[model samples]
Target: MTTSPESSGGATQSHKPACPTAEMGRWPASWEQEMQSTVNYLWHTDDLLGQGATASVYKARNKKSGELVAVKVFNTASYLRPREVQVREFEVLRKLNHQNIIKLFAVEEMGGSRQKVLVMEYCASGSLMSVLEGPENAFGLPEDEFLVVLRCVVAGMNHLRENGIVHRDIKPGNIMRLVGEEGQSIYKLTDFGAARELDDDEKFVSVYGTEEYLHPDMYERAVLRKPQQKAFGVAVDLWSIGVTLYHAATGSLPFVPFGGPRRNKEIMYRITTEKPAGAIAGTQRLENGPLEWSYTLPVTCQLSMGLQSQLVPILANILEVEQAKCWGFDQFFAETSDILQRVVVHVFSLPQAVVHHVYIHAHNTIAIFLEAVYKQTNVAPQHQEYLFEGHLCVLEPSLSAQHIAHTTASSPLTLFSMVSETPKGLAFRDPALDIPKFVPKVDLQADYNTAKGVLGAGYQALRLAQALLAGQELMLRGLHWFVFSNMAGVTEIQELKRAAELRSKLRTLAEVLSRCSRNITETKMTLSNLSSELMKNRDQVHEDRSIQQIQCCLDKMYLIYKQFKKSRMRPGLGYNEEQIHKLDKVNFSHLAKRLLQVFQEERVQKYQASLVTHGKRMRVVHETRNHLRLVGCSVAACNTEAQGAQESLSKILDWLSHQLLQDRTKGAQASPPPTAPYPSPALKDLVLHMQELCKEMKVLASDLQDNNRVIEGLSRVPSAPDI
Candidate 1:
């Protein structure tokens, strides 16, 4: 219905991408069926996203993982009538899995509803067109940032082309970006609603593209025909890409604003017959062709000539009046990729033969190249300063990219280095360069000791020349200590020897352990048994036992033990043993009785006192158990309260269910007045079925039947059958 700085260029012969033969109505393999159920349950109310003539979108989150998603809902009555729903985007995006393309997660049909829903990946950052023109972005993007947007756009467009899909609308609104977990911004192509699949046939004609970004052929040839049989190919998308880039790079559209009666005619005239009216000032690149639109490039007064040269050509191809040689992302890449790759630079150092053909990536920063120089020249990074044509290297700018477009191969760039006069600097200097004269002292013993002390870590910081020159003459005529170590080999040997010695010690220890192991197992088992018995007895004995009970138990124990002792001192042993017994003046039975009486009275009184403490502890435990039971009851009450809260979604879902069940078979086709519950039709059917089962449950109780011949809670429907 509206224009988007609409446009296209001339046609070029290339292989048209083939349409995937798969049908579009089904969900892609990436969708999880189980998630579909959760999605329906948790997505109670949808956050309205936007509305358009064809469909409305809403934001919803997965209840389980809380992952955000977008759902596109088709109009119910209109959907069921003529067009049903175009699931083209589902089919297209299902087949697509590119980082720059919006992902389609699932396809959903609500119960008895004519509307279909498409669940898609969510992009929090809205449309690029909005950001550029809306209040959020007070000013347009900077050139460097705009270039990033361009790269992502081209990548997305190229993906579409390769897949044999044309995103008929290539304006900024169609492009949106998502910020990743690592704070990386990724732009994605959305609203495949306007996209159409391409076949092997070279000519493709559609009148559905937005007016703002209409290709020239669509207006001049297609609009001119009787039925508007506009014939074009993927080149149409390329032209729109140009217009988008122009709008993105420059803060405004190229075509002049038009209104009143013949708006389309005025816009078409400006697109075909005339050049762009720069809302924002721009410089023209006149190298490509006489067509001013092709030469319509960004104002690059502050930009590098190389960048301009690379960009101007591609812009020329994209906006070319003739579709022939139209630049898609392929031509764009070919033009820009070269300057980003290998760069040729001449190196000039004072007092050394200058070298030509120094090759490095143009995209590399001066910092990175300097590091490489550090490796080769032995000059530290901090000490190295590079000069590019007398200017300090900055911006670490991309080299082989469009920057080289304006540059000629004949005027090769020269890189000059001014290294500080340190030891590392001397290493980078030509060996023939003069040095201050001094005697080189050689102390092999001291050097070897130092190397041994620190090289246990297996690192050596010695120059190759110094290592060899330590014992030999004719080395550097200077005095400087170069750290050298033999620990690399010594360290390896020490590790191996130590590992072997440990292994031998372990073997010897094992042999000694085996010799000492014979009685240990038996002793340990005996000790373990004794300890278990002692613990069991101690746990059973209550310090709270009554003193009288304890005394009775002790008396019984004494009687049993006394009889055993009496049996050992039997009368048969009187003659020989009686004399010895008499010699054992102590009365064993008497002594045991005296000791029991003395300790029992004192210890039993103390033990009985401890019983009062235990009784109090038992009372506390009993109270805690009672309190825990109450907490359990409280949790059950909370569950009932939560159930009450669940009624919130009931009214919403009930209304949705009513609309969904409405027979649209004979109704007038119009936009459905309201939306259904966010769940899929399958889930709704499940909930309804479960409800029906709940009503029929009283059949399990025979006595609960009603006198009216109805099964108590299983109240029959009034004239309708339960489904």
Candidate 2:
């Protein structure tokens, strides 16, 4: 049946009425009144929807519901058609309830003529054939539109196969398109007039399908009227689906012999039956010209290669003339299901017309899609904001690519590559360095407060570490002066040699402190940028998992603070030697007096005053610890490294007190020096201990540098969205 170009339901329409009128052969004039009175359905006689060989469809309205429906009225000749065929269509439609299949409303009878009419759900967008006939779609349907058609048809056919039925006629004309409430295009299979119960492996002798889409075996006996023994199985529908898919993809039949498929049926059948393996299509321009063959879709096709790679294999397997070679409905359904589960998204970065076609599974989240987009455009994931149908595409685990594709597949998703602003106190260098600027902000205020507390504690620990580093350097400088400036108050030859050895030891310790200081400076610079980066992008963490991660980081920071406090060296830069004196056989009276005189000297007193200033400076730095703002796991790492530096400083102070300084508080005056050679057994033991501390400090500096490298690596980690 044919219907209005603007309004197509069960059938299509044209200028003249497709049904039998008074001029041809009309039913009674009162039949319309009888139909309205008996069935409560008013048929618009002027609005002919479509006309087929035995029926005419019209636009009709139900009086009780006031809902528009398509009315398929069988002509007088249809009454003489097979009773089994008529009953089968009604039964099939009544049992079917799928979104991809046309819906049947009611079967009403006309009182005057006693004629039956089918009322089905009306589709305003008409048939797919009409859409493909449009000038813009002359080449083929657009890729998205083609995918919709392909998926819907496969779903409808799969539903039929599940119910042990086969739609002998599958074509674009038998499929209808409707605009959904959300403006999404939906395709539904209609006109199941040729459908019948036929399971796999079951055979039927009848041949009933459009010639262009018919299998060669069916074409031979049906069109040529040739004697044939082979019966058609359920696989016949696969042949029709292949033709429909090819037509929707390229706007032409896959096999067209010379003079077109309609005029040269014998040649078209030969072309389809004689195709070699892997051959996909055949074309001929003239009756006598050589036929051209193609193994894949032409370059003019709009579909992406990713889609064609999956779709073409299904076409090749099902287009086979031999039923044994053709795929079963299960394989066909599985292949189509895979295709439906994957979507090709066209992403266009704003201000540039170039489009990136990204392929992703329908189940993937927006975050995953953004990562793929970043790979294509080199835009940082955190700097990308995508808009689909004018709504921001945010990270939500429940929302997936399928949902977006369902709602807004007509237009490319617009990607706005946001330029991140520079964080305060940090100058921008390379754009690539700003990749991980987006850090998840703590959701709970209590957690945030706890984070700040940990940062304050860490800042205090770093200050203590710095103070210890300063003291260690001061002690090294003081020891250097004492060892080389003839202030040791020793006269023995062995004592002079021991002093030279001590001077060399002091130089080595000084070099270790220098390296440690460099490590501290570099770490501080790294933390400054890391803290600013985190503060600049305080995107809220909505997910419970992300919140837990933030809490875990805070807990680790508190642990590091505790460890730093526990490992802190005791204050005063001197140790109690009462235990050592009890064990020593020699008296230290002479050494103690010499140390006191040296400390009181003007040159040594200047170094002593500098030490007191450093102690006060540490106190002031600690007072301002709470004012410092540091965030992220990187700060926690800094605290850990500071703990190592403090240990190193403690070792340096221990060596200074053990090997060089005397306890001046033990003031027993003018006792004889040790009778044994200078730097007795205890002093030699202290020197060896100092050498070990130097080696440990080198390792500590190396570890601090390694930790700094770890923090730098964190800047490159992509910040995952809070889904």
Leading candidate by lDDT:
2
User: Which digits, one per residue and each the tens of the lDDT, describe model 2 over residues 1-723?
Assistant: 122122223544334432332334444675554333226666656666676666777777676565667877777877676899777778888888999998998888876877787888888777888777643354567677888898889888888988998888777787888889999878888877677898797999877777787878988987777898998899888998998999899766899987678788777877888887777788877886777778898654556555777788999999988888989999999888988887677765442223456777877887787777777666777766555544345545356666654423235665544442211111112211111111133123323233334333222222222322333332322222211211111111112122222324345334322332333333344434433332332221111132233334334554533433332333311234323322221122222223223323422333344444433333322222211212113333433644565577677667666554453223224353556324456766766776676575555445444534543332222222221
lDDT of 2: 0.57
Best by TM-score: 2
The stretch of ten residues in a row with the least summed lDDT in candidate 2 is: 485-494
TM-score of each: 0.40, 0.52
For candidate 1, the 10 contiguous residues with the lowest summed lDDT are: 476-485
Task: Please give the distance, in angstroms, between residue 325's alpha carbon in candidate 2 and its true position after superposition.
Answer: 0.8
- In model 2, the runs with Cα more than 4 Å from the true position are 1-38, 63-66, 285-287, 342-676, 679-723
Global lDDT scores for all candidate models: 0.43, 0.57
Query: What does the lDDT read for residue 37 in candidate 1?
Result: 28
Q: How accurate is candidate 1 locally (lDDT)?
A: 0.43
